[model samples]
Target chain A: MAAAAHEPEVIRDKAVMRAWSRCRRAEGKAVALVPTMGFLHDGHLSLVSAAVAAAAGPVAVVVSIYVNPSQFAPTEDLATYPSDFAGDLRKLAATGAVAAVFCPPDLYVRGRAGHPAAGASGGAVSCLEDAGGHAHETWIRVEQLEKGLCGSSRPVFFRGVATVVSKLFNIVEPDIAVFGKKDYQQWRVICRMVRDLDFAIEIVGTEIVREADGLAMSSRNVHLSCEEREKALSISRSLMNARTAVLNGNNHGQQLKDEIVQTLKEAGGQVDYVEFQSLTFSLD
Target chain B: MAAAAHEPEVIRDKAVMRAWSRCRRAEGKAVALVPTMGFLHDGHLSLVSAAVAAAAGPVAVVVSIYVNPSQFAPTEDLATYPSDFAGDLRKLAATGAVAAVFCPPDLYVRGRAGHPAAGASGGAVSCLEDAGGHAHETWIRVEQLEKGLCGSSRPVFFRGVATVVSKLFNIVEPDIAVFGKKDYQQWRVICRMVRDLDFAIEIVGTEIVREADGLAMSSRNVHLSCEEREKALSISRSLMNARTAVLNGNNHGQQLKDEIVQTLKEAGGQVDYVEFQSLTFSLD
Candidate 1:
């Protein structure tokens, strides 16, 4: 069959999506979704590349552009998460992506409209406690994947990721979804979720895209100062060192972790966390 | 504006949904979705009624027909739940439903493949621990709503409802999705989920449609014995008594619960749970 046409790039609402599906059925084309938060970097591009390669037919890569508020902690840089829609679109186009950017607001808060009680407007918002009746009491909790690593530091982070990713998977309805492996825990958690929920879409974890100096490309990289950027290279370097150690028969979990932590500290990098567990076997 | 032509109901795969979106935009019509499992009843019909009433243009009620395994507990009757596609379609047609049912086994199982060792044979399994990895790892936790009523008896019930409902919402992409309040907690949880997740679609909760004798129409009602059917009337009767007590200046929480429990027992019915909580002035 001939390849499907890729004229319509941006689909905002559900109606457009339905029509898109109808046309694809006529052409026997497949869609690949690359969900992102709009600040497209090399890491995101890597996911797009993976999506393009994995799709069997004409691909429709939907990059959801919303910087989800639920995923961010109150103390985190939610308000200042970098967003470059124009730049993101140009980057996506450069990759020959037949992708639509879906960007929505952070808060779609709705109520019967009687306003808040008194002057409680400008207080420090406790995201967990203040959710009160405002947030849907329902939350997606991924057990083992969420208990360690980033979940240790940011308690609510994976819950937010699981929920948002679930929403995107539902909205985009892609044959395959590409996620960068740099957020290894997130990728694992999402994979677990997809398997648990039985979302038909195949989740492809793209290899970590790196900078010239070997630092993993992250949106948060923009937050690092010149010196911090130089120091951040240690994080990737430490992982490489750990990998080398594992290859050289250093299979002891604690030994590999200790070596990586020592290397990072030596390189002037603040160690967030460094731990090793058997890849195939359960830690417990 | 003229009403858009209703497209013939077509079951589109994940790849097709994207293409369908683009085609609809070209045709100048928005898509509205109403999601339902097969085995249609008045409860589901009520949601379709709401969807048709709220839709602006060509509406597509993508009835996802899948008996989701992740939602059922091991002890619950997952195998026995009713499913009738022909009968459901007939009902859909009566409700002016314009779209095809988006039934996919994997779509129904969205978020369920946590245990890699379990493999593909894990079909239609319950959330029992021994059922292995195909058993649900992620659950939608609803706080207060899950504290009383049916939740007490069926611990995994609302979680299953929320997860499946979420999957349906994502797959259908409705502008206005309808839900029947027969599953009152389900309706409330979904409303909260849509708001919390910033889903653009409007959630319309339809009032419960009951049998002539007042027992809520449920797919499980088919499993009830003739004698059990007569006994089930006590559930509604107990609810009515509780409502009457609250209306008669019964402000004490314990007293209201006690009265409801007593009324149910007096009517030769097993009391699952009776709970009372202060209704927020603002939520009202």
Candidate 2:
């Protein structure tokens, strides 16, 4: 707790971050990780808080602020992804729970050791071409689970997410990691990656944080016009109504999903999907 | 040195293997890993010797003996792959360089937990289905590197190698790992994976050990007839001739490759390929 009162030490080098975690573990302190893509909102901070609360005893919380480029398709908003490093640091500092801030400029850049044999580059390369020259080509895929939901639209997204998170897990070596449930498929894909790959880390999913009017918190919310923002509220409202319906013994999956879709369209929003999944993420 | 006099402890559980490495690291001892598929040969033991020599100081060398199922295609020899657990232990014991033997029964099983939402399984699933029910869906691929050469003939091999080696790296947390140059592409793929994925470990590729009669030692050699085995000698013989040819200024890639292929065919052997690759694995 004493360490948290001040701003967390920012770590740019991967080695420094790893060493810090190793040193803390040697002192019998548990390390918890909260991975984020900068521009922290309440949802991201809630994950930080959840990491602290989830620990058995005293814990060192590391918040990584990286907008991983691998998860974005070339046509996606890689260039315009929201960011505020100074504000993010301020927000993390205000929480008084973070022990360190890992803000690497690029995790995909080849290190001092060059890889000339990386072969002629092609196939699902990380979206960002390193300004230093050379693309990172190693990829992690969760096969079947990465095929539906957001994956259908953003084909390369989960591979990017899984690969970057794998790097963070290796670099931080956290005993536990916290993820916001708002990115539902992503959280499950990560869980499956950890499970299937035998990473010795526990994954904790925290609830979605919303504004008072019930719009899910997202850094990209800044890009929306006032009219668009109001229309988005229909999604959360219909979800709440559907939840009420389900609890009131109207638990039919299709009927409930149809209601949410109707509500969103009536509010002038194009619906992509409104699916109900089981605890294990099988579409019900 | 004291450990070399006794048989190494065989570790079956993944968690136990991780804990052993952790405890050793906490005491300031470095750990080295040599991953194998359990049919030990002199070629394998040489790797252990190399692992010991490669260490900067006294190191705890762990040899993992798991024939990873994920890297095999359905038509490949997952079921028929050779095994000699007791004999492997004796051979490793004879070397006296090993500190532990990690021989897990299954790394891809769903652990103590279940994964019912793994979705309808299809697409490059691991060759082995878990008797316990759930299939392991997570896979790692070194996209570009895992193509051509052996990867062309055995498409799933390098993916299996990369993924399982990743599991071993995570479980063993070795300070350095020794791989036989006999698996040239595999060693390079791992090095690339370490760099691309930011694994904080050193990779050492050891020279391939061969039999006195000039046959490259392989477990599959047992299945060959005596006459067939005699014919197989042409492959290594031709390779040696090619090396001599290159050293003697006959370095034309196509001309040298043609000599080896012609020799193999004349000796009643099938020529797959005789490639010249750069240190970084770029085919000449």
Candidate 2: segments with Cα more than 4 A from true spot? A1-5, A110-126, A129-134, A279-284, B1-5, B110-126, B129-134, B279-284
- Compose the digit string of candidate 2's lDDT tens values, residues A18-39: 9999989988999999999999
- The CAPRI classification for model 2 reads as medium
Score chain A of each prediction against the true chain A by TM-score and list the results.
0.83, 0.89
Clashing pairs in 2: B4-B96, B71-B160
lDDT: worst 10-residue window of model 1 chain B: B117-126
lDDT of each: 0.65, 0.83
Alpha carbon deviation, residue A9, candidate 1 (Å) = 6.5
Best by lDDT: 2
lDDT digits (tens) for residues B1-284 of candidate 2: 46445689989999999999998888788899999988989988988988898888878899999987767776877789889999999998888789899998888755333443342122444465332345577778887788788977776788888989998998999999989888899989999999888888989998877889899988778778999999999988998998887777665778778888998999987766678887224324
Error of 1 at A275 (Å): 3.8
